[model samples]
Every structure is written in structure tokens, then in C-alpha cells.
Target: MKNTVLITGSSTGFGAAAANYFAAKGWNVIASMRDTSKDKQLNKQENIFVTHLDVEDTASIDAAITAGLARFGKIDVVINNAGYGLFGIFESFTKEAIQQQFAVNLFGAMDVAKAILPHFRAQQSGVLINVSSGAGVVGFPNASIYNASKFALEGWSEGLRYELAAIGIKVRIVEPGGATQTDFLQRVWGEGKNASIIPDYIPFLQKSEEMYANLGANSDEDAVEKIVAALYAAATADDDQLRYAPTSDIQPLLNVRRSSSEEEFNSFTNGLFLGK
Candidate 1:
């Protein structure tokens, strides 16, 4: 039987890349996005289904799954890839913005998992892949809320893996971050521009920018293509691994965090953003 993978936020970047990659591999692709019109060519591919899905809306989530199942009898994998970064000073974050960040990054993912697990439970086999970021573990400068959301996701996935494993469902988290040119980063830049910046925080924010430009995220030899490989690895692996830091600088940076003493780590992290 052919495998069907349902991916959220498939209109662009990693999600869009993944949709095409999986389809090319002959897997049935359910490319769900808030605006399906964004990629008119996505549905044109063979063995692909394009559908409207707003991660924040439970009704849309349910409908997308229903439509996907109707088109492809079974969904073998679900990639919770619908999320964005809201970066800037914490004090500048409006209440609405903070809530929206968690709503899409944490709660929306949980809701999607909840909606899909019943099917996986019945089938006794499925993969639930969450596309997390380096922010999941490392707190980037001026990205407190973004860091918080990804950290919550990391913790949630760790806790959920065992329960899902018991039902033959494999939960995997793919961590990738540190690229500045992707549509994701562009969105972050645009969103941050509108945030009401406090004068006192301006210097700190500039330092953060310097940190990112000079000593920012770790880079792998490969590019975004590594993400597709990582997703494929998670979806196809028949092992007990729960976390993957493929194609991003997360793994090496994680090494730095693990090898350093608490004080040393603190000094190192602060140095990037504080220069102290």
C-alpha cells in the first residue's frame, strides 16, 4: 500500500518543499495550508491533495483530515509543520501576539495530534512528526516567546512519545533553525518591525541582531534539502529515536550546550546577545 503523509503549513518554505519531496517519492501528499491559493501548482502534482487548513481552527483541522482520508484511504504520517516565529523584545509583545504564537505553535499542534491519533490508534501504526526549530532548545536573543513555544513543544513531544509508542505510533520531532533567508525568517522580520519597541530595549535588540549576524546559528554542510531527508528519516525509521536535528545547526549547538558547565553555558549564551 502507498503511504500518505499529511503536512500542515504546506504553502511555502519547508512545508512546501516537504510536500513536493514526499510526492516525488510516490507518497500520497495532503498539503494543508491556510491559503491554498498561495501555491496553485501544489495540487497539480500526481498523488497530491491540496486543502485549506488553518492550524488555529479546529473545524478546519478536522475537515482537512476528513478530506484527505476520503482521497487517500489511509494517512501513514502527519507532519505538524504549521507555525511561525514572532520575534522581538518580550516587553514589546502585545498580548494578542503572544497568544497567537502559542495558539499556532503549541495548541494548534496538540489539536492536530488529538484529531489524528484515533486513526493511528485503530491502525496500530503511524508517524507523528513535529517540525520544531533550534529555538526549541536554545533561547535566541529577542526570541523569548518563540523560544518558549518551541521549548513547550519539545517537552510536549518528549512526554507524548511514550504513550504514542504504546499504540504503535511513532512521535518524532525534527529540529531545524538558523537560516535567515527563508520565508519563515522574512515573516519574522516583518512581524518584528511592527512590535512597539521600548527605547530601553533598543540596544539589547541591536546586540541580538549582531549575535545573529556574526555568531548566530550553526550551519550544516547541506541546505534545506537536509530537512526533507530528516522528515523522510523520521517517517520511515522503525526505531525508538524521538528527536532529530537534521540539516540544521541544532545538533552541534546542542553539543556546545551539553558540554559546557552551567556557568560556562550561561556566559556563552549571554555573550552572543549581551557581550558581557
Candidate 2:
């Protein structure tokens, strides 16, 4: 019997890569995304099921899981990877936008995990992976909203692990560093660019712009492969480990974070964030 995985945000990036990886490994994959039209390749695979799953809508999440269960007979893993960046001066963002940010980044993952638990419980075996970011533990300039959502995800996932482990379900968090698809950051600034019309914040915003530019963070083809490998490990591993990095790119930083004291952490991170 082959194990099956259902992944969210499969239209592109890590989610899309993970779907292809799992299918190639002989596991059934339910490659779900908010817009199925964007799924250009996975439909060609015999074991991959492409479906619609708007994370903000519990109905869509529930329906997608239901469809996957029906198609694959059983789902052994759930990868909650559907989220976007919402970067800007927090003041410039409206309450609605912040809410939507959390709706997708935090609440959406929660809803997906909640919806899939019954199946996991009944089988007494499963893995749940939340695609988090380095931003979850470390803060960056002008990413307060995005950071908050991920921080909440980190905390929630950590707490939920204890609850799920006793039931035979393992939980894992995949944390990639600042590097990610350019389109992700572009989508963020595109909507909030013009909104930064408040003159009083111009200098700070300009500094943030320069800082982001200087970071030179961008994902390449190899990154997709690394991310998929991490996802596969997280889904298949039986250990009590709760966190993973796609590559050594973020390992040193994560080690520094784990080993540093609060003051040392703040000082170390400030130098990176502020170019001190």
C-alpha cells in the first residue's frame, strides 16, 4: 500500500515542487491550490490529483480533503503550505489586509489541520507539515504583519505537536530562510507600494527598501528541489524532531538562534536587519 499526501498551494513554489516530488517517489499526491487553472503540469501525473483549495475558506479545505480521501482512499500526510507575504509599514496596511494575512497564513493552516485530524485519528498514523519561514523566529524590517502571522504559526504548531503525537500523528515545521520566490515579495509590494504615501514615514520606508534590496534574497531552480526534499523528509520521518531546514543555507542561522540567549539573539539579529 502506498502512502498519500495532500499539499496546499500547489500552483507553484514549494507546494508545487513537493507535489511532483512525492508523485515521483510513488506516493499519491493531491496537489491543491486556490486556482486550479494555474496548475500547468501536475495534472499529467497519474498519481497526482489537482484540486482547488482556497485556504481562507474552510469549506474549500474540507472539500479538498474529502475529495482527496475519496480519490486516494486515504491520506497519510497533510502539507499546509498556502501563504503569501504581506510586507509594508504596518500602519499603511488596513485592518482588512492584516486579517486576510492571518486568515491565510495562520488560520488557514489551523483549519486544514483541524479538518484532517479525524482521518489521522481514525488511522492512528499521519504527519502534518506546516511550511513556515525564518521570519517565524527572526524579524525583518517592514514585515511586522507577515512576521506576526508566522510567529503565531510557529507557536501554534509547537503546542499542537504534544496533542497530536499521543494520537500517533507527527507534526513538523519546515523553515526556509529569507530566500524565496521573487514573485512572493513582488506580490506584497505591488499592493502596498502606492499605499506608502504617508510623507512622515518616507525615510524609514526608503531604508527598508534599500535593506530588502541589499539582502539579495531570491529562489532558484535548485531551491525548489531542496525544499521538496525537506518536505519529503518531514512527511516520512518517524523521529520526534519538529523542525527542518531545506538546506544548510539556513542551518547556521538556526543554530545561532537555538543557542543564543535573548540579548545575544537580539544583538545578532539587529546587526543583520539594521546593517549595524
Clashing pairs for model 1 are none
Q: 56-104, model 1: which lDDT tens digit per residue?
A: 9999999999999999999999999999888877777678889999999
The lDDT per prediction is 0.85, 0.84
Q: Write the per-residue lDDT of candidate 2 for residues 154-245, one digit (tens) a residue.
A: 99999999999998999999998655334434444546542344567667666666656545454343766878898999998879999887
Give per-model CA RMSD: 2.4, 2.3
> Which ranges of candidate 1 are over 4 A from the true structure?
179-194, 216-221
For candidate 1, the lDDT comes to 0.85
